[model samples]
Target chain A: MTYLNKIKIFVLVFMFILFTSSINAQWNIPADAKNKKPPIDPTHTLVKTGKDLYKSNCASCHGTPGQGNNIAAIGATDLGTADYQHSHSSGQTFFQVEQGNGGMPSFREKFSSDEKWCLIFYIKSFDKDFEISGEELKEQKADLRLSLVEKIRTVKAYATTKDKSGKEIPLEGAEVQFFIKRMFGNMQIGELVPTDNKGMASIKIPENIPGDEEGKLNLLVKFKDTDTYGKVIKSKTIKWGSKLKIVNITDKREMWGSLHRVPLWVLFSYFGMTIGVWLVIGYVVFQIIRLKKL
Target chain B: MSEVNKEGTKKTIGTIVSDLTRPIKNHKGFTIWILFLLTVMGVGMMAYVDQLANGLGVTAMRDYISWGLYISSFIFFIATALVGMLISAVLGLIGIKWITPIARIAEMIALGFAMWAGLIIIFDMGRPDRALNLFIHGRLQSPILWDVTVVTTYIAISVLLYLLPLIPDMPFLKKAMTDQAKWKQKIYKILSFGFEGRPEQYKSIKKLIRILAILIIPVALAIHTVTSWLFAMTPRIGWDSTIFGPYYVTGAFVAGGAAVMIAMFVLSRNYNLKDYITDFHFDKMGKLLVLLMLVYFYFNINEYIVPGYKMKAGDDHHILGLFTGHYAKMFWTVQLGGMIIPIILLLFRRMRKPLPSLFIGIAVIIGAFFKRYIITIPTLVHPHLPIQNVPEEFHSYWPNAWEWAITMMAIAGAVLIITILAKLFPIMPIWEVAHEEGITNEEMNKYVKES
Candidate 1:
């Protein structure tokens, strides 16, 4: 080949290497051992049962083999991988399956108890086991089962007003405030909760409200009357407990008027002055021009 | 001077008023009807003022039909003003002495209506207060700026053309006055600029008029060309065309000729000017109108036919709309009544007579207004994208009462300006008339006898 032909070949090869190297760099994965996981075989019966249960219910989102590769699982974790399973507990998975996570519909009423267990088993099969102590298992079981102390940290309120059908109306825009028991305990922990547009308010107990051993918190929740000045129309109290959850506090008196106002005099005066000044200036100019012409 | 001979000399205001009222007293029916029409038009103007105060929403024009009757009237005014340049400037340069008698009238009409066009454009703007922005932020690239520049130039030149020859006539007017008010005397003195009709002043005035007459022709063409570019520059399907500039100039001449004919008919009959503006002038104007109409028709064919034949995808909706769709009636009426009918009417010798030609002129003027409306509105209705997310009212345009009232006010305002100008200055060019009679005694006597 001629020297010119060799130069042309070298340039073509250089361009091909540059393009392929850029494409490879974009698709490169980290070589960390922690990030890598052995794939699970679907032929295992336990895995197969989990896959069947998931397909019948969760596969629409979690995908076959719990890969979380389904269309609905976009922006969600890939469940078939071991890395994701290690971070979550069996109890947390069961709760998520029963209550549903963001964008995932709840299977609480849809699946039987055995089917949920099978789904959980399939999810677990993706991870290699780590040690679990007796104390940790007891703590996990205790947290899974909702007790009175565990339930105390949550509260739910509903709107009492309704149409002619007498069904509870969704109350939105109601303000809910919580106050501590001690004297001069006026410091507010959180901002006021304006009820949702549907007129429902939910308040969760703060975790720092010292455990039961630290002198019981005398908690008081009052529905603030928006129309009246400094008025507390409705009040509720929860005695010494780890936390308190009040559900459905629906009273007609709990509904309050809005706290929005616009002063009329200020609006009118501002506009009036602007228009008056313009008219006077215009008139004066016209007179001056007329006089000059005359 | 020369015993102020009433028959062959200037008449006093009292004598002129007596002479003018004598015909009115004898013809009460015609006088009363004219008075009644003037009253109605005045009332319409009062209603229009109410519209200006309230806003354009008083009219049927929604956003879709933004430039409605107001825009049409503006186009009509600009088109009419073209006649002044065509007659005074173009014919004067060519040395057509026959057009001299009516040159002042054409110039006055052009001056009055061109000024009115500027006012009407401001009135059409949603934010009339922002009209000064057209100058302040004016982009040379914009056709609107070009329009503003050319129109301002045209108006200035037209006013100068209308005023220049009046220098010699001003002394005649000043001396002829019997009960002239103080302000009127002052105005006449100032306007006359101490014109003594000296040889130098006369020569200077003639030179000035000649310069202006030469300058006004291209400015006249530019004004209409820029006005057409306001639409043609847009991306709208019907409006984007290379032929629009010359097409618009031809239409301007057609409309301008019609306007001149109408003005001549009205002023001659009302002012008893039959001797000055005779059947011969009408015959000449009729022939000019025919020529202009033919030229305009040829441009119209180029404007509408080729794109219409190709039926380009973008233009299909707009073309179909004009051809046999929603705008068919207006398109046919304007094309036929404005161009074809006037051409045919003016073609016949008998129809070129004053009465028939006057009717044709009126038809042409009204048709031209609708032609402008068709030009502006249909293209807006069919923009590049499909109309969406807007109220149903935005899809179509019809001028509301306010638009109609304001449009009428603009027309009345133009007429009012012409009337006021005619009152101040002689509608006929007095100096030109006297010059045509001759500068020497024996020649003047022969001219008197010949007439």
Candidate 2:
């Protein structure tokens, strides 16, 4: 038993080593140079170009100063913040712009090299202090005023169970759940709130949330066990204007009953039995005829 | 009288020619009708050309059921072909006398179906023109390559097995032809290979067959095992199981047995081979089917119940689908109607009668075809990633008209080959049967002396 156990352990270790080595061999990046970079001048021509590009292209969605807004650009990122810019590299941004990052479309075919440089320049302009000085401050302010919307303060929820006759039905103590997904990270944040007597609940956004400058947030409201429990009742993303409401979460659930609900094993068994029976039947018939003829 | 005896000796060729042609003269009408039906099936195959020109989109197969009937039918052909190896080599090695008569027929069926299997695979390919890439740039590590290798080897062995025995018969056929058509004479002359029925030629034939029989066992196992590996190697929940190799082989034998039975029934009824193929043969085959069915059932239980017990998140969809989900109807019908019912029916003594067994055999073949479909499609539908972005029609697959027509054409083609062969050659081994029944000259002399 001891020897058998040793052999089993040996095999396990061997397999682990084999797998790790194969993975290591496949990754071609050098380890040491992952974190070296040159300092940036916030007011360079590159920076002005970047700013101009941002106003024309990105401001409509990401908003002025990268404070994300614009209904169509609800999922766009904020580039105004210093910490976020310093944490990511120009190469990373270039790659994302070139190849497309998630929902973003590729700009390689649409933009020229100088245009890409201009976009990068505009992105850097989000920084407050810079060495290069030729840009007019008035134009920048005008762009900002035209694009910027008030930041989201808080989200409030209201619910009621009544027909269009305006008669109110009690909906207190019903569990309400809120879900938020970040646009860039696609991370999900959720909280469950019990409805008050008026069938209303509000959630306050915590100050100093990580990556708040990016401002890409999608919110959803769902009720627990209201015949549409475990289903998304109401959902909306907040990007530009602050006020967002989730209504009729229950109606949507009835309209779309769980589209993604198939279990994996059921499909497997389906194939299994189908193939299994066909083979079994064919065998029996062939045998009988074969025997009779013999 | 001596002069008359000389004339008789000289007229031996003429007499044999008349005897051989007699059957064709009598059955020409039936032969013409069967050929006409076969030609219609050939016309159906032209529709498949339209599919090839259009694309697989021509088929009803949606993304969900991407591998519909063609794949299943391919599996059926592969499984049924297993008998060629099993009976011809496996039983032959074991010195089973009763199997010898049918061994050649089994081999021929194997070869015919194996060839059709290749053809159907080409038909199934999204890029049929790229099929040569399978060979030119074939990767040995891939199970598909292994399948290709083994199937080709099996075909070669099957042809050798069929042809070697025909050598002796070929010379006899050559001399027996009185008014042979040009093509027939040419074919006979080429195939005869100047065989004179000498002892040396007999010894060489026997020796080669023995060698081939020994070699064919591993090749046969490799063919089905490699086929199973095609699925098993995939990461799909149903196909990734290790039990697939033996599971596939068992299924292959089961299907192969059914194919052989079906062939026997058709040939016996058509050729009036009552003397050679009898009820006793059916009884024996019924017993074999029972054994195969039981073994398959054991594997089936293991395949389903073990996974069903675990019901892991990955396996959840597939298992539920078979149990009470969308595919539940097909699952239950194939398992119960195709396998369990046939097994139970064959278990009783009365049901083992030739006619009843024939009915059961046909059921097994039909059921096995659907079983192959179940094996392929559902697993594909339930991939690791969620289904998205594809068109709604991509979610399910049913055979389109072109696919159906083409697939039917393949089946028709196999039957056509069998039909043509039966017309030309004796379905039963005349020499072997003569020897077995003690009707040979030596056997007659022994009987006379004893009397």
Model 2 stretches astray by more than 4 angstroms = A1-294, B1-29, B36-40, B62-64, B175-182, B439-451
lDDT of 1 by residue, A1-294 (tens): 999999999888766655554444332222342343323322344444555677677666556645456553132346767766776665566666676543456788988766666677678766767321222111100000011233666555543444456665554565666555655664343667766775555666676554244335655554554322134333334443354343443421121211112134433443453344335334433432332132
Recovered fraction of real interface contacts per model: 0.00, 0.00
lDDT, residue A103, candidate 1: 49
TM-score of 2: 0.58
Question: What is the CA-based DockQ of model 1?
Answer: 0.01
Prediction 1 global C-alpha lDDT: 0.67
Candidate 2, residues B1-451, lDDT tens digits: the string is: 1211212222222233344334443464666868775776777667777777888777887756667778788888888888888887888788777674467668768877888988888888878989999877754445676687677767766776776666555655555553656787687666656555555655565666677677667777878888888899888888989899888888888888887777777766665554345676777778888789889989999999999999999898999988899788988898987799999999988877778888888888787888888888888778898889998877766676787788888887877776666667656554455445444434422332342
Question: Candidate 2 chain A: minimum summed lDDT over ten consecutive residues — where?
Answer: A139-148
State candidate 1's TM-score: 0.59
Per-candidate TM-score against the hidden true structure: 0.59, 0.58
For model 2, how does the per-residue alpha-carbon lDDT over A41-129 read when each residue is reduced to its tens digit? 34455665566566666676567654545433223456667874775455555555666543355789877766775676666555555
How accurate locally, in lDDT, is each candidate? Answer: 0.67, 0.66
For model 1, residues B1-451, the per-residue Cα lDDT tens digits are 1211213444333343344323323443554654654775676667666666777677667766677778877988898888899999998889877687788878888987899899888877767788888777654445676688778777877877787777656665666543556776677677776665555566666766776776677678878998988888877788898888898888888888888899889877886766567787888889988998899999888888999899999788888999999999999999998889888878889998889989999999899888988988898888677888989888898776666666666676667677666666677655566565444323333332341
